[model samples]
Target chain A: MDDPEYRAGIIDLLGALAVGELTAFQRLAADAELAPTRADQAALAGMAVAEFHHFEQIRDRLTELGVALDDAMTPFHEPYVAFHANTAPSNWLEGLVKAYVGDQIATDFYREIAATVDDDTRALVNDVLAEAGHADFVVDRVRAAIDEDPSVAGRLALWGRRLVGEALAQAQRVAADRDALTAIIVGAPGRPGMDLAELGQVLSRLTENHAQRMAKLGLSS
Target chain B: MDDPEYRAGIIDLLGALAVGELTAFQRLAADAELAPTRADQAALAGMAVAEFHHFEQIRDRLTELGVALDDAMTPFHEPYVAFHANTAPSNWLEGLVKAYVGDQIATDFYREIAATVDDDTRALVNDVLAEAGHADFVVDRVRAAIDEDPSVAGRLALWGRRLVGEALAQAQRVAADRDALTAIIVGAPGRPGMDLAELGQVLSRLTENHAQRMAKLGLSS
Candidate 1:
């Protein structure tokens, strides 16, 4: 039973997710200049396209749960928008790390939260997370860039750290601003969602993938 | 014969076209937000994806002509970037009009310039301009928006005008900077390319379609 408290948390998270996708779409598209060839540009465009697919899942789930998409999303826009405006990547490798580290973390959070919802919402979130594709493209691009210039490693690693710190800061804002949602997610298991332990496990998995990816790109995580 | 002047105009124009496709790709992905439903948003995304196809064509031509795609495009980035940076649409409808009106006029210019090239380049340009596969989608969306809210008509009409005017201003700059290429087009009949008069008529036809489309959307000159 999604009482107002829990519903608010889900809405808070979903709102953040929607805005994140919107911002990512803008970044990926703008970042097409980082691409070396027309084919590479199209590949980034494909990744940008995938973000919309994720957006559809989150937006539809919100609509079905009786939250107006815009209204639910309106509150979370400012902080997240400010975060992106400040941290806009200045180069190709920076952009790739932003996409790779940031999206994989967001996906982890969404998956953790999804396990706490009802069957329907779980299905929708699961479906969206299932399409979790394209990080490989980011990894490939970063690895190529790093291969060409080993010096890019240090800069990109630092950029990745900055993005994660900002993401966690804002994510905390999202979780704290809506206690009901946070409580529901934190107190899941028999109630309806994944408990905190399960959530951590999922996060661990996401982080491992990120670490491995960075190492593949010749960067120390 | 193929010379720097001939290439200067054509190259400037081609570079501008590549930028347009790149920008269009980014904008369509961003504009997917303007759609009301998942299907519509996905449709908008599909529309944006097609720009990459045209983008690849232009890049290939640039490569064949021994021009570095980025180098050919370097000079105009600030001006064109300033143009889009200033005119970003806040909603779905504005985004649609931009795609519809802005792209339509661009297609007109592409068609005209394609004709001014040699049979080979003209053939390639024709392939690029061939009916602008997204025109129908833009028209449908514009009409639907107007149908939903007639008030949208007046504003969109003005917006359409502004898009065209801004584009024309940029077009003049592209032309002035690439006079040699312009000469090739305007002087192609006697050179290795096609006829300029034929290009003028082709441009007229494209413009006719644009006007008809505007009227269909309840927009006007």
Candidate 2:
């Protein structure tokens, strides 16, 4: 709160998270509609509900920090919404893969960014980012689908790549649009933060985790 | 579980509630998408998540009763699904009104039927039927909309009526099809239950509550 740029960066980070969680809730619920069974629908819908709770937590934190939740969330809304629009899944399997892949990237990004924030904010971010066991459900369903029809593996793999591409593109768009936030991630003048090479390593880790997730789902990264 | 009719009726009741909650979660989440703002979307999505919890509780209870969840839920699935399909709202306001009115009527019917069940099941039904502050949110939003455009009041009032009509028609369809469930409601031979006259009174009470809800929403019932 003392340094204006640092404060703005934190706000920007949380604001983006708030908007991201809100949109994730919407997308997950919509994707759940594509579920083939009531049980599966309930499973995906539960994940959406969990995302809503995360949205609330971040939104409440914004209010607690004396920021108007809507105004704080406004900056990153367009990019996040556009990411979802651009990568809208073509089918149920695609939706599941998107949910899994998209969420993993978001969680990883938040975890990495968590290190640069204050202790309280770091804990909040980490706590909210926990996947709530949705990963196993997604992995089981995706693997079963691939086992049933080996041909789907190629399409789903391609879909996973597209999700990651759209996610990264939107993230870059956000970073470009929010300079303070970008500075925060790459470190301000005297702050401890990621240098360019370290930033490259962060990206590498994100994609590496993405590959592991795809492999777990029986799809190529 | 000793009496076949009683057992079947319990299964039918739980099944219907499970299906109702599942559809409500989907419909509420979809409706949340139409919200004019992210705040409103989160508000409605919170309600949808509450519905999902109720769905899970009922599904779990079915499992505890040694009933196969899907088979237990199957009997009421078509009626609930058809009701949603036929009465799908065309816009945000209609969706809000339908959620409030539809959920209220369902809760009322369940409360009445709860009287015919064992204490444990009755308690479970009542617990799940409690709205998680969703009614106030819907009422506030719907009332504000009418305040913004008085003309929408007439259209919304008509929409409310259609919702109730479709709901009652579907309720009747479920009752006619599920004999054990109907018999439980109307009273098995000597079981303490709603007599025909008592059932008529229940219908009047449901409509009366619906009218009060509409009035509260600043719409004509």
Give the CA lDDT, 0 to 100, for residue B101 in model 1: 75
Q: Alpha carbon lDDT of residue B182, candidate 1?
A: 65
Predicted structure 1, TM vs. truth: 0.68
Which portions of model 2 miss their true places by more than 4 Å? B190-192
Lowest summed lDDT window (length 10), candidate 1 chain B = B185-194
Report, for candidate 1, the interface RMSD.
5.2
* Cα lDDT tens digits for candidate 1, B96-193: 88877777788777776665665777787778766656667777878887889889899988887777777767767766776666676566444664
Model 2 agreement with the true structure over A57-80: per-residue lDDT tens digits = 998899899998777888888898
Candidate 1, A1-221: lDDT as tens digits = 44666667667767767777766766777776576665566667767767766776777778787787777677777667777876788876677787777777777777777766767667766676665567677777788777888888898888877877787788787677766667767764445655568878877886787687667667888
Clashing residue pairs for model 2: none
Misplaced by over 4 Å in model 1 are A1-15, A34-40, A60-67, A131-133, A147-149, A188-207, B1-19, B27-97, B109-162, B165-200, B206-220
lDDT of 2 by residue, B166-197 (tens): 99899989988999899878878767777789
| Model 2 local distance difference test score | 0.88
Instruction: Return the lDDT, model 1, position B99.
Output: 73
* TM-score for each model: 0.68, 0.96
